[model samples]
Target: MSSLTHTTTPANTPVERKATRSAGRRTSPNALLSKGVVNALLIVAAFYTLMPVSWLLFAATKSDRDLFSTSGFALGDFNLFANLHHVFTFNDGIYLRWFGNSILYSVVGSAASTFLCIATGYAFDTYDFKGKEKLFAAVLGGVLVPTTVIQLPMYLLATKVGIVNTYWALLLPALVNPFGVYLARVFSEGYVPNEVLEAARVDGAGELRIFAGISLPMLAPGFMTIFLFSFTASWNNFFGALVMLNDEKLYPVNLGLFMWNSVTQQQPEYYSLVITGSLVAVVPLIVAFVCLQRFWRSGLTAGAVK
Candidate 1:
């Protein structure tokens, strides 16, 4: 028995050496350390992003006096209701009008923009037309050019067309998103298979009917993505509103809030109203993302499989 044990012990040495080498790797724990570092960075990033938003939240709850007196994060006299009352009742409830205007602009403009983008992209993907590539190149070039750069040109054109200072002024400009067209074309290529379109064509389906029945449904994710962008742009269209509109009744929420904020220097009481209005303005954007994000996420694999 003792001789056998001694012989077995010599054979176990290689296995033990292998185990020891693995144990040495355990000492570094590189993967765990990497996860810890990554987690730390994410926490820091989250905190940094949330800090101002946190301040906005707590500040919104406070009265005008508490806003000045208390630390930004500290809870103060809960004047949220009063602030809301002031916001809605001020200037014959003009804030509500502004809010409604924003909703109309965002909803109408985004929907129209999304539809136009999907159609244009679908056509670009499916059809061969005269100078199509050159036309698309021009559209791509439009993406490179900043919207601000064309503001003057657009303003002059709108003036010539007699659409300035109108809803058309805001909505028309939003309809021509080069980036949305680009995204739609990509989505069309991936989501709407050429084979499916060919099959529809073989069935004697018209182009419009095929798009409405099949391709549009497949392009749901692209539509939502473009809509979100267009909606946000229309909602926050402060500079455009500033340039085009002189009528307070036609003002969108951002421009309305800006008008309120501009007066805060003289009328300090308007400060709370401005903050509360700003908070309210953010709600639609949040709601939009929360509602549509699932569609966007699920689309990544929606057509990837069968």
Candidate 2:
């Protein structure tokens, strides 16, 4: 039995054992350290991003005196209702008009933009036409051009067409989103199948009918994504409205808030109203993202698969 045990243990000398130990220590320690560092960094980033939003929530509940005196992160007296009342009831309820205008512009303009983008994208993806590539390239180039840079030209065009102070000025520009077109085209190339289109064609389906019935359903999520993007962009648009609108009645919520902020310098009481208005303006964006987040995720995955 002692001879058999000795023969069985005749392997794994000191050098072999040392080498195995060395490899285990080298690989395991480095991998664990890397994972730990990554987790720490992610936590830090999340905290940094959320801190300001947290501050805003607390700040909105405070009065003007408390806003300046109290620590920004601390909860103040709950004056949210009073502040909202002032925000809505002030200036003969001009804020409500601005709110209504913003909603109208965002809903109408974003919907139009999404439809146009989907149609343009579908055409680019499915059809072989002359100048199609050039057209798409031009659209992408337009996306690279900042909206601020074209503000003067857009203003000039609006003035020439006598649409300058009207809803048309805002809605027209919002409808022509280059990024939405690009996103739609990319999504269509993947989410929409050539075989499905061919089958629809073989079934004597008209182009408009196939597009309305077949393509639109597949593009629904993409449309919603573009709509959200357009809505946010239109909602937050300050410079465009600032430049285009002279009539306070026509102002969107962003510009109206800016006006309120400006007047707060002269009339300090406007501060609480401005804060409340800002809080109200932000709610729609939050609601939109929450409602459509699932669709956005699915759309992204579908696009990636193609």
Candidate 3:
């Protein structure tokens, strides 16, 4: 009665604690709305990205009449096999020749380009030279320049060298990929540690041996990445092939397809062949990426880790 009994009360009761947790667990309306919007945008982006490819897949399966009359995305009379037969047998199987040439240019040109880039990049990274930085800066400048700007000049040079309209015209120009060199240099810096090279040197290993046995393994991923990039670029090099080559026998698939597509306006029968040829032309690229994606991923990861 005289004084208040000194008593302590809990800051929060069980009911209040439960209510607090419920409030904490509940997501705000704005957050849910934002999440839904993000998901919707991604769905729309995916559909937009894939729509053309889907249309191409369906179009390649249709006959000329069906290609024009039927819905662009709908399945037609299942003429893919028939169209492929035509693509292979048409014009004395010229498509096959073009396909072979495409493979030749892509494989040989990309392989050689990748090797040269590796060696050059490794040299720049490992060895001290008088004007290394300046040379590399020049290469970077080349990367910024557009290929189209130099196509005419390259053609003129090819003509002067008497390699115009030849396979060398196509292959030689492709071997000098500035971007590939830049990428390889970056990869070498990350993957090839100096200590390892020094150890090898001390242990009686020559530069070539150290590079071939040790450095090359670590740089495998980089090599694969460069090869894939060069291959794709060479395969799709339409303008360069157009300007440098006139011989139908040396034409890559891109120029060959462009030639077919140009005539499709007057010769409507070439429509299915063109579509089918394009579909076939891209299969190898798809296969290549699928096969080498693991190596590419590893290479990227190695760079990140290093």
Candidate 4:
């Protein structure tokens, strides 16, 4: 009787094992195919995005004569140093002045913008004031307004104020970043808890003290993100510089590069300088993004969890 029972059990176990194996087999092909397609698309997209950057890097190393003649992907004569030398030494090192202007505009403008955004955002998120919703909606509307559409009017206003050719034109306009305000508002809502603010108040801390001591540290990641965005925007601003700055001394790198490109049409040698200048100009932004990427990611994910 025990042998007969064991035989029946073996038969039941085989049937169960076969059923489980068949279920797994049914799902495996579809799962494998989906994963394969996703990976393939990602690889293709990555190549497409990287191709232009790769060309720029290799193009920067080539001499003017070889730039058009050489294959886009192939390495030409390693003339990167020579090109940089030309870029720096041309017109009494004017490119260096442009670089300096860009740095000043980006750093100072972005810092001011970040501070203002933080203060305003904290107020909007933490306080309930008269017409607060209306004011915020107005700000959101301002964010949707195309910057280029306003550039002409901004330039006209600057011209009327007689600050068009000065650094004020660039710096002043950049300090009022609507997007930075929007981002800061979103970040502050997530980072600065109402309960924490109330607790700080209960502890007899003043509003300013509470913000500085408790909220600012929590908003550091958001501040970094705003700084990066404002800096990049200010650094890469072309139209503002083009319309406002007629003085080459006040021109940022983007405008300076544009001027060089304009000359390239008449003088082919300027092409190399333009390419090299572009490569150099982009390096700082790349370094900035790489260094602050962790902070940026943290800021984006800050309110997502809790």
> For every model shown, what is its TM-score relative to the native structure?
0.87, 0.88, 0.87, 0.89
lDDT of all the models against the reference? 0.87, 0.89, 0.91, 0.90
lDDT (Cα) of model 3 = 0.91
RMSD of 4: 3.7
What would the TM-score be for candidate 4 when compared with the true structure? Answer: 0.89
lDDT tens digits, residue span 1-306, model 1: 455443345755888999988888777679679888999999999999888778878888898889999998998888878888889999999999999999998999889988999999999999999999999999899899987888888889999999888888888898889988887887788789999999999999999999999999989987887788888888888888888778899999999998989988999998898889988888898899899998767655544665
RMSD after Cα superposition, model 1: 4.4
Give me the candidate number with maximum TM-score: 4
C-alpha root-mean-square deviation, each candidate = 4.4, 4.4, 4.9, 3.7
Clashing pairs in 4: none
Better of 3 and 4 by lDDT: 3
Best by lDDT: 3
**Candidate 2 Cα misplacement greater than 4 A, ranges:** 1-27
* Candidate 4 lDDT by residue in tens digits, 1-306: 455443344655887999988889778988889989999999999999888778889998898889999898888899989889999999999999999999999999889989999999889888899999999889989988988899999999998999989999999999887788888888998888899999999999999999899999999999999999999889988988988999999999999999889877789998888888888998889899999999999998866876
